[model samples]
Target chain A: MSEKRIEISQLGEFGLIDRINRQFTLKNESSLKGIGDDAAVIQASGDECMLVSTDMLVEGIHFDLSYVPIQHLGYKAVAVNVSDIAAMNGKAEQITVSIALSNRFSVEAVDALYQGIKTACENYNVDLVGGDTTSSAAGLVISITVLGRAPKSKIVYRKGAQVNDIICVTGDLGAAFMGLQVLEREKQVFMADPGMQPSLEKYEYMVGRQLKPEARTDIVFDLEEAGVKPTSMIDVSDGLVSELFHLSRHSEVGIRIYEDKVPIDHMTFETAVEFKLDPITCALNGGEDYELLFTIRQEDQEKIKKHPDIHMIGYVHDRKNERVMITKQGNTVPLRAQGWDHFTE
Target chain B: MSEKRIEISQLGEFGLIDRINRQFTLKNESSLKGIGDDAAVIQASGDECMLVSTDMLVEGIHFDLSYVPIQHLGYKAVAVNVSDIAAMNGKAEQITVSIALSNRFSVEAVDALYQGIKTACENYNVDLVGGDTTSSAAGLVISITVLGRAPKSKIVYRKGAQVNDIICVTGDLGAAFMGLQVLEREKQVFMADPGMQPSLEKYEYMVGRQLKPEARTDIVFDLEEAGVKPTSMIDVSDGLVSELFHLSRHSEVGIRIYEDKVPIDHMTFETAVEFKLDPITCALNGGEDYELLFTIRQEDQEKIKKHPDIHMIGYVHDRKNERVMITKQGNTVPLRAQGWDHFTE
Candidate 1:
């Protein structure tokens, strides 16, 4: 009830998180890991831990209904939460999805949304557990919490990376960002002329990447199969550069990446070129790829080196304050994280 | 893309949940329980199990900011999620809280909200582990997920009631509902004349019940201490009749309650009469009590009969389709559930 009001925009998302988290202290011995990790880890029993993560997606801030299908929205919601668990190298066992919608939606629409949720659950071998269904005053909001399990020794955290470890990434990036651009363009065109058809067939892959991105549970399985455990892991929901910064800050290590080694899909590269955006920049800064980013021990490099989808993009180094990217043109530039800044334009 | 738009209001809240859940099937061996229970139970190691539950509260739909303080809202959000775990006879270990707010809110407001969340966490002996913070276009939204632990043999479910079990509820009912009425009336008076000072000292207890209700975790402890485990259990977020119906339907048993056994505080009863509302109806249909409702075996009844707060309200019977309330005058009437139907007026 103080008369002084300080706007949220003055402090960005990370600043706000730091401010809020500073006030809380963990009280339970079962809480092995708290606010700073991709998912919270709790000790369930001997050598076994349970991981929990929650995410909330608001309508205009997270998605546009005109471009994103309701079913895909549901799928993406569950997938994102699952991705948090996968980042910890755990197998997701269950998920609870809570959604609030306005009267504008229909029963059929809700069914379609749950259909996408069910599909993700089936694909990830997770059970849809309990949830809250309620009405919202405005647009739709979806919140999902995923529960996962892993051996205590196998669980990875953002602060575990050591100097000289090889940094790796899963799948190609920038596609989801390019897909979002295509969807936005189509939406504008449709708004201008309702009769005109959207020319989106050529951008189908990018569009799908934006609409229904999958979590990298497969990568977690592959890593375990190869007998490789990541020293540190994080999911790339906020651009690669942003997540890299997080790993660097949390692990207290420097990160150096070769720009050419960063994987970008051919369609995404072409679309970025057509849109006059730097493909490498798009690859570094495009958010919502739902890909896994991790650092592995120098000794474990050979085990996962030949994996098809696994890309060795960089290495962790001893220089604590420096994070740089070496361009294909032989220029080294300090990497800047332009991740999703919800407060600013 | 279908032209037919069936509004969500036409089906009601429970109808929407039923429609959505019908399509999902559990595929994991670790998933011992799913959508219908208070918390989903996941098989962990030998004897331990993990319980997960989620709840979402939207701005105008669930609370009014004009009368309800943000701190109380934050506390209530955590309390409700913890109540779900208590319903499963489990101890909550950790929680993840996700929030979405518009720019209109200040850093101070966010702090106040988290202060309440931290208070609840400290009081409940749970860890505030992880959460996501984001911006929303409309009003504020809060979604919380709680993780709890219990022995596999001690976990309670909603479908385990026997034919002759005694129905029990903890604490009093209808106070939160009447408390809400008091706040609404005060809000109206204040709106009519801004300079008017509202007099609310006499209704402090009722007001607290509405603003900051506690989950009956103590009852779970007491029951365990008395060597009694509920055959079936559910938290009374929705009214007594609505929760009774849930227990009956899930357990495939009938329920009969006596009017004289229903617990109502004197202030709440008087307030209901003042508003020209039926006291029995308010006790039966009023929501947000956050009390424990469970069924106990007849043999164990003697153990809890002297507990002051535990009310022996009803009994389960063999008739599957019958749910009735016996009046003090000895007339039996069918019980109807009208518990906070969000979709319907």
Candidate 2:
């Protein structure tokens, strides 16, 4: 055998995905689309299509177990996957969760984790179906796959955005990212002096957003209720700008937005200032918000304009290969996707 | 923190699963069923129901990297999930695959794995939709979730079997187990003397069964074509006797089988003998065959008797609590389930 070795970090996550995806091609008629999307869409019988999405959360990388409750971790796992399904404009019906844990977790700990998972299942109205529980050599790993259903006419893809579609997002961004910073700070403080109780009561909302984010399934339902179908959609898992680039690339369109329109909670803004992180940058690049980002026809805007949670931040444009954001100070600059890159430092 | 530590092996795999599942309760109308079955069935908009199944394969416990190819591992991961969908008597439509690997893996290694995944997706006629790629601290882990669809009338569950139903299974068993034994033996031999070539040619058939076991999707198709819906169905992932126990427990029906009727391939039998193992025992207790086990109404037997791969093994009985096996010597004994228990010694 040859003694050549190559590290995965050299290729990075996206490079690795590209390499792997290049070898496989879809073979089934039922498989409407594969890989390179928020969720995979399958051709189901009748006028409905089935959407499938999967996500894996690893200990240390995705969350720090020191501060994250096992139950919240479980709930967050399901929520993230459901968020992906919601990104495809589908209602999640079922989810299967697989976890690999070390011996450090007790039966009580396992129960707590399941409690969170059960709560999320209830909240999202999805059934917890089949999953495998196994032992891991290291920290915990949670992988969940969610199944969703959407009418063919209402189903949205990342590639369906038109040149002039209005870009919309649900809920405020950057809270989850800021919440993570607070948690990490508290953890460090607790570690340094065991006697000092970390003050977290004032940051309850941000902390909740970080520890247990909710999937925007309600937005999916509201879109249907308002008789509006998003031309393109994606859940904000990898920052707002990263997901926007995905939509722009897949739909072959350009995007332009105003920084003032990006929703950022007041607490998040204050916390960002305290943490010495730019509020706008955090909103654009800090991910795990579980908010829906989509495009709507200009005529349909009137229907969802009344929704308090939905924020119209940008518009799709015909200028291909350009995605820019206008600053509050009147400077226009190109948007770069500095999303979460797990591989590179 | 008080120093109280418990090893996961203390509770074992099933015990852990039970502990985790006990905390979750279904709350959605769309969640027709959850956790316990081969797949979770969800109510879709149409007459058809959606099925979801998930499986996780861990390194060292599930596969040995020394002998197993990464590509085959990927294929097996998808195949196992497809088998779960087939057990529900549904047509698999979409799958989400999540992989976690350490930096030791190369871009080429990742490609090999996905190549196998893509091949299986094509062969099973299922689409690979969405998944997560993350870095791991240890060996590679693959988790797959499959989504399937079938009309409510055609869906089969483990609890549907009745007394007097004919018990049937597709393809031969024990080949994969025997193949694993052969591989282990060769690995030992090669480890002891690097210059000696592996005596693998004679065990090629058995080895293939271990390396690339196909899911019994064809049985699902054949049953549909024959217009015979199984009263109860399950895939043989854990040994045959274990699966029998599952059917018996779920359907609340007794089962009786003849040892002579169990299908054992010629290569498996020969290899088992060479390894000083019982072929019948291997057929009963060996796993990873990915075969289908089902019960059919006695009157419908005539329709499938002509099918080449499907084999009649036994019949369901009114003795709900008794599950027995008849030996070649005319002796009857209770069957024990010693399936793949990773936690057991």
Candidate 3:
């Protein structure tokens, strides 16, 4: 109530997280890892540990209901949380979804949302265990918490990447961002002329990437089947270079990558150019891709080298503060983390 | 998108919850129970099992900032979720707190909110594990998921109550509802006259109950010390009568109670009288008390009869579909569930 005000934008999202993380220390021994990881690790029993992660998606900030179907929003909410567990090299077993909505949403609309949630639960093989549903004063808000499990020995953290570890990523990047761009354009066109049917047939793949991104739980099992374990892992929710910064900070190492090695789908590239955006820049800075960005020891590289989806994009090095990218034209330049920051935006 | 519309208010809160619950069946062996109790039960390991519960609080729907301090809001949010774990006869070990706030909240306000969360964590000995922070388009929203553990042998469920079991409630009821009346009255007074100072000295206890209700976790410890395992239990969050209906429906039994035996604080009774409200009706339907309501076998009555805070008010019977209360005037009346339904409101 005082006149003194400090805007949250000044701290940004990461700065605000740091401010909170500094205040609480883990007191329980069951809490193996606390705030700094992709998910908190709790000792379940003996050599097994539980992974817990949560995500909150607000209506206007996280999604535009005009273009996003209610069902896809529900599915995406669960997938994003499951993706967090996968980032820790664990399989999500259960999820609790809490939703708040205004009366503007109908009962049939609620049914469609749950239909999508049920589909995601079946797809991920995760139980829809519990949740709280309450009415909101405004738009819809969905918050999901996922529970996962992994053997303590196999659980990977973002801080374990050693120097010379081969950096790997699952699937291509920047497609979801491009998909959002296409949706926004279509939404604008439709808004300007209500009778106009925005043709999205050409951009269906990119639109699907934006509307219903899938969690790469398959990649976790594939890595295990290939007899390889990532030294460090994180999901690419906040663009490629931004997540690389997270791994570099946690592992206390430097990153060196090649622009040409970074995988981008031809469709995504063509769409980015059509929108007057740089494809590689979009890959580096666009958010919500939900792919796995991880590092494996150099010795383990041969194990997954033949895998089609896994791309060796970069390597870790001893220089702790240096993160550079070798361009397609053989120019070495510093990589900027233009990841999504909702608070500042 | 359809011309045929079904309003959510038509189904109400419980009705909507039932619609969603009917869609998903628990598929995992680790998931012991889902969507029908205070917390979901999951198989942890060996004799231990885990309890998971979540609650989402919206700004205008759950609290009004003009009267409720940000710190108390934070504390109450955690306490309510912790109470759910207690309702399952388990001790909460870790919690994930997700918050979404608009730019209307300052950095200092966020700091205050976390401070309250930190205090609750220390008081309850719960570890702050993992959470998500995002921007909201409107007011602040907090969603918390609490994780707890208990021996499988000791875990309690709502369906475990038996005929002739003594029903018990902890602390007093209706005080929180009285507190809200006082706050709302004072707000109206202040709105009519800006220079008028709200007089709250006499209603401090009730007001505190509304703003910062504490979970009856100590009662769980006391029951363990007394060696009395409740046959069934639930937190008194939706008033005494509504929660009793829950126990009746889950256990398929009848409930009989004495109006004179239901615990009501002197201050709460006096305040309700001053406001021209029936003290007994307020006690039966007033919510947010955060007290424990459970049923115990007749043989265990001797174990906790002398405990000052634990009140024996009723008994369960085999006559299903009959839930009644005996009045002080010697009249038999069926109890009605006027529990708070945010959707209908």
Candidate 4:
């Protein structure tokens, strides 16, 4: 109640997370890993470790209901949390979703949301095991907790990357950010002239990327099929550079990546140019990619090197706390993290 | 898009829950239970069961910053979910807390919130696991998920009560509801006259009940110590009678309780009388007690009859869905559920 007003923006999201992590210590033996990595690892039955991760999405702040379909919002909610479990090199099996909605929402609206949740459950083979639904004072809120499992030997941590490990990523990046840009611009156009039909035909793929992002559980499967256990793994929810910084900090290693090797979809690149923005910048800092970024030892690279979806982008180095990008012009530059920070915005 | 507007209030909370429960079927073998209970039960390793429960508290909807301390709100959030785990006769081992706050709050405010969270974790002996922290466009929102474990043979569910089982509850009830009433009244008084200093000394117990309710994990420990496995169990969250209706519905049995047997704290009774409200009505309909309500086999009655905090208020009967209360004068009246429903409010 004191007037000492220190804005949350001053500390930012990761700084606030660090402050939170330092305050609590794990007391229970079952809690193998606490407030670090993508999920908390707990001792389960036999030689397997259970994985738990949580994500919360707020309406208006995280999504504008005007442009976002309720069904897609529900599916994205589940997918993001499942992606955290996938980041731990585990298979998500169950999810508990909690939503708080204002009465302006109808029963039909609720059903539409659940339809999306059920769709995600079917696609990911994850069961909707538990959830809490309540009335909110304002906008809708969705919080999901995903439960997953992996063998103790196979479970990966963000701190396991070592020097000479090959860094890999799944699919492409920045499409979702471009998709959001197109949607926002189209919404503005529609608002200015209600009679004018917005031309969205050419931006379908980008729009879909923004409207519905999928968790890369398939990559987790592929890694298993290739018999490669990633030395370190993390999901790319908070952009490429930010996540790379997390891996670097946690693993006590440095990163050296070729900027040209970073995968960017053609649609994403063209749209960035149309918007008068740098495509590389979008790829590096556009959050919510929901792709997998991981590292494997040099000896293990042959297993997934030829896999079409997997792209080798970088290597871990001995110099700790350093990250750089080698450009197509053969120039090295320091990497900066400009990931999503909802508080400041 | 349809002109049809079916307000969520039409179905009510339980009706809405039933609608949600009907939509999702448990697909995985690990998922043993979903919805309709205090917590969901999942299969754990080595003949053990894991209990998962979630609760979300939205500011303005669930609490008011004017009268409720931020720290107490943080503690109450964690306690409610831990109480759900205890309802299943399980020990809560880990909890994930996710919170969203607007910029109106400061870094010191967040620290106060987490300070309360850390206090509760130490008190309950539960680990602070993984969670998400984001920004809300409006007021604060806290969502907590508690994970617990119990032996397969020991885990209690709501659907296990049988005829002639003694219905019992731990500690007292109805105090928390009265506490909220007192706090709201005091808040209104202060708002009406800015210069007026509100008096709350006489209502400390009720105020404490509303602000810092504790989870009855001690009862869980006691039941283990007494070698008593409750046939059915639930936490007293939404008043005594409403939770009784749930027991009757789930166990497929009738409930009959003596009005005089319901435990009411002395301070709670006095405060209700001073407010010109019926104490018994408050006892039956007042909620947020965080107490354990369970049914023990008649044969196990002797084990806990002398236990100071345990109060036997009712018994299970064969006539399904017939819930009644016997007055102090021996008159029988049907019991109705008017428990907390935020949507209708």
Candidate 5:
């Protein structure tokens, strides 16, 4: 074999996506948008269109069966896919879930997994459409594709942010990351001493955040009701800083955020300190929070200003590569993203 | 620890699907059909509807990397998903391909896979839409979701076959199964004697059939041109008899076929005989044939009668569960589906 071998780690995930994306050109007129966005937009009706997004969660790579409940895994699978649709400012209506698992999984185990899936379907008002089920060689793999609907007028892309647009994020950040820390710590303790039971009572909030994160679809509805469409939007799945980089690049704008304004739950902050981690760092880099992060036009900021859950953390500016954060002491520091790279890790 | 453990193999794949299907109800108005057809039907526009179908291919469970080229595997993955859309008598326009691979695969391998995916996209005239790329702990897993469009009037389901309807199948069958046999035999031979070079010149047709099965989208075009609508349709992915059983159960009709009329290539027949296997049984129970199987009205038979690739193999009867095949010697035998059950195997 004379072929040159280039390791995938050399390109990394995003670089690899860029390489693949460069090769294909959209041929169908109905395919309004393709690979780059959170969800691909397809023309549906006269003024309405459909949004399609997919996510695959592998067993050992994405979750640990020993610690993560099979049910929560099912629910999280649906939620994360739905979050993609929500990031597009659309309502997810249908999903197809395909699962591949080894024979080690039982019928009762599958039932419990589906139980969580069904619960999520009800909660999100999304219908289960179609999927493939088959056996895997090793552990479980869940891949879900979600379809969403929105009027063409209401659709927002990540490339639409203008100068001086206010950046807003829904709910507190880093709680899910902290929750993961707690779960991992508990698992380690239980593994060290088999007879000692795990005590999760004190970390229930953060633990639940990690186990059963919700897509911020309600925020999409709230913004619509308030007549304030986000200039640009994205779901915070790969850390706040990483997603901000995406918005900045796509929108071709700079970003300025205050570290003091970054939302962090009290429990998350306290736990981060206890774990000898910086709360601000966790809020910026810790991922899987499934929160909506978006930028609104300066004129529309007043519409959602009084909203309890939404926080105004930053603003978009004209300088393209000048992303920075103002510390509590008023020191301007360049913001660097330490996003999760599953491949390299 | 006290929970009852019922193995998944006990229920088989179809039984497990039934159990999962019973627990959910479609609530979205856009969800016209869910979970029961080759593709889920969603109301898109006035009379225009969209079809959604998904399929997942696991490395070891579905294909062996030792013999199968990664590029061909990628093309086969897309083709199978498109075949599902073709089975529904719809034109597939967009697809999302999500792949999970471990570090064992290189950047060059990933590029080869995407190259095949791109070629399929061009061949099918389908747009490459959104998908997830993630790291897996083991072998490669490819999950593809396809979106298609057809007028509601032209859409066909699995439950529309009428009594005495003529069953037509596109292209020849069983070649793919034979191809698998040849590949597996060569693999074993190579394992025993590593220096032996595999000479597959005589088995090219069958080998290609197994490695890169083409979807019968052209047949769908031919049927449209002939102005014929199939009463019920399904893809022959899980053997001809298994698909017949699906149509029978869904349409509440019996199936009767002539074994002599079943199309088998000379190469397939010769190969099956060489392997000491029954050719007719291979045609009956051999899976992975991405051919269209549908029922047409008696009046519409002449429209496609002269089609070179179309074979009139069977007919639908009034009595449910009375499926049988008449052998070349005129002896009737009960038709039973030995469909592929990966879990059980």
Candidate 6:
């Protein structure tokens, strides 16, 4: 009872992970790489490597069942875990999804959830290998572990980025953030007036981004086909600036991205304006857009220079801790990341 | 909403798994086997194969924080997952433990939980490769996925037990169930009078078994050393009779286990009597023992006959649907499995 008490918020989520992960070292030889990557890398047979990643989504903290459909929840859960494997430039082959839910969820509800999971498996060409379902004392919890593989030569790590490498991102950023905003606004309106019906037709694009995000596995295949392997890669689940910080720290290089070059969907920008928020800030700091961010060597830039889905945003610098963004009016600003800190009150 | 109100309890856990797993087929060549086992089998190179399994433990549903220490909960969680690998006759190499917890847990509490996880990792020689830690809106949720490997020749499944195979079990049975009964009794007493000190001196063994159940990985090593391969193997988590039912159903063989041969610690028997419960019934149907149950070919039984820990219980029979138990009094009774159905109110 007299033991010391420390608030988890004092050491945020990242700090907490660092503290815990520091105590353990990779002991198994097959464990090629452990904590601190999008996915752990393992030595597989045939001189290939495997990628393993797991994510747990809690109902109330991660999603509100009242607004988010169970089907989309199931799909998003699979997509985010697959995004981790894709971040390692690997194709996810199998996934195990375990869920814990209370009796409030019916058999039909579970069917709807699995239908979406099956849909994702078909979409990504992944197989559902195994999972456990147990009763929860409270709200629903879904945890998915994905196993993937790539040839040893094709595998990439966050520490592979180098000076002058092009920093590229797949798909537009901030749309999913804007989508969440619209969903929240609509939920409030509906809550305030119970008899009023919600109209989501106009905001479907943005809402869908938040409800059903997809992993950019196709881009991994495209890069392999084009014979351009990214030097370093990470999934953009924690906002552009936050993931950039990860790549910079691990690769020990600085980065400079132009704000004007940051990709933003038309609807995202429009919604940002309507919400009286800055589109650029949302693109830089809003999370949950499961896009791939990676750096490519200068010589490989011509391989996919005209690829419409890929956007070249910046270049890596030589010095670490010197990340910046050039504004449209020739002003350079230090990029700030207000990433999610769930532990913080 | 009118589609279906079928209760999950109607199908039961195994039936629900059957209903769900029947819809999906393994599409990837690397997926050697999917579902219907303690772990999933995946094709690995070098004449070996890999095993993967997952288990999710919800806080209130799986453990009562008031009586269960967080550290032991963490240790037991990892141990149970490792037991799944051992059930497949494989060595667990890596595990990803993802947890979602609310702010009620402090930094010190999280540290205590990780201390147990780290201890288990060191004890089992399994690497903690990767995991996701997120905030839960309510109670704590821990989901662990383990990856293991074994030579193809050594791998064992539940379907391989043949008629006349000698059934074996590792370690004593039903102590953990007795342990839970002891703990729950002490908890009720303490709750009735908070000032009363819990007299757990005499119940240390049972209490330990309940709080810290160790996986029988040693039996796997012993079997290998003895050059004996179990025709089929499974971990006895949900009571001995339930596991026997699984082995019987999967192997398409009936089972005849002698009640006199079911190993029960003397303390467990006496404690069951103290709790006004039948000792044999407790050994047969009480869950969470985490023992290894298997069937060895009659010729291979001699190799492990003298193994100090392994107990030869009975034999597999030819009649697929006829399972029975021979009591010490020389009477026979049909074996029944009142398995753990968490969905039941």
Q: Give candidate 4's root-mean-square deviation (CA, Å).
A: 1.2
The lDDT of model 4 is 0.91
**What TM-score do all the candidates reach, one by one?**
0.98, 0.94, 0.99, 0.98, 0.99, 0.98
lDDT of 2 at B225: 93
Docking class of 1: high
Q: What are the RMSDs of all candidates, in order?
A: 1.4, 2.4, 0.9, 1.2, 1.0, 1.2
Residue ranges of candidate 4 with Cα displaced over 4 Å: none
- Give Cα distance to truth, residue B155, candidate 5, Å: 0.7
Q: For candidate 4, write residues A100-214 as lDDT tens digits.
A: 9997899999999999999999999999888888999788999999999888888899998999999998889998999999999989998999997878889898788788889
Model 2, A56-95: lDDT tens per residue?
A: 8888788888999889998899999889888888888777
Model 2: which residue pairs collide?
Answer: none
Q: Per-residue lDDT for A1-345 in model 5, tens only?
A: 237888788888898888889989999999999999899999987898999999999988889989899999999999999999999999999999999999889998899899999989999999998888899988999999999999988998999999999999999999999999999998899999989898888788899999999999999999999999899999999899999999999999999999999999999999999999999999999999999999998999889999999999989999999999999999999999988887777
Tens-place lDDT digits, model 1, residues B92-174 = 98999999999878999899899889889988998999999999997899999999999999999999899999999999999
In candidate 1, the residue pairs with backbone N, CA or C atoms under 3 Å apart (3 or more residues apart, or in different chains) clash, namely none
- List runs of model 1 lying over 4 Å from the truth: A1-3, B1-3
Q: How close is candidate 2 to the true structure, as a TM-score?
A: 0.94
Q: Where in model 3 is the C-alpha error above 4 Å?
A: none
Q: A-chain TM-score per prediction? A: 0.98, 0.97, 0.99, 0.98, 0.99, 0.98
> Which has the better DockQ: candidate 1, or candidate 5?
5
On DockQ, the candidate that comes out on top is 3
Per-residue accuracy of model 2 over B1-345 as CA lDDT, tens digit each: 235645667778888777767766777677787877888888776576888888888898789989999999998999999999999999887777889888777777877888898889889888776688998878888998888888888899999899999999999999999989989988999999999899789989889999998988888988999999999999999999999999999999999999999999988888788789999999999998889999999999999999999999999998988999999998999999889877654
TM-score of candidate 4 against the unseen true structure: 0.98
The stretch of ten residues in a row with the least summed lDDT in candidate 2 chain B is B1-10
Docking class of 3: high
After superposing candidate 2 on the true structure, give the runs of residues whose Cα lies further than 4 Å from its correct spot.
Answer: A1-7, B1-11
The residue pairs found clashing in candidate 5 are: none
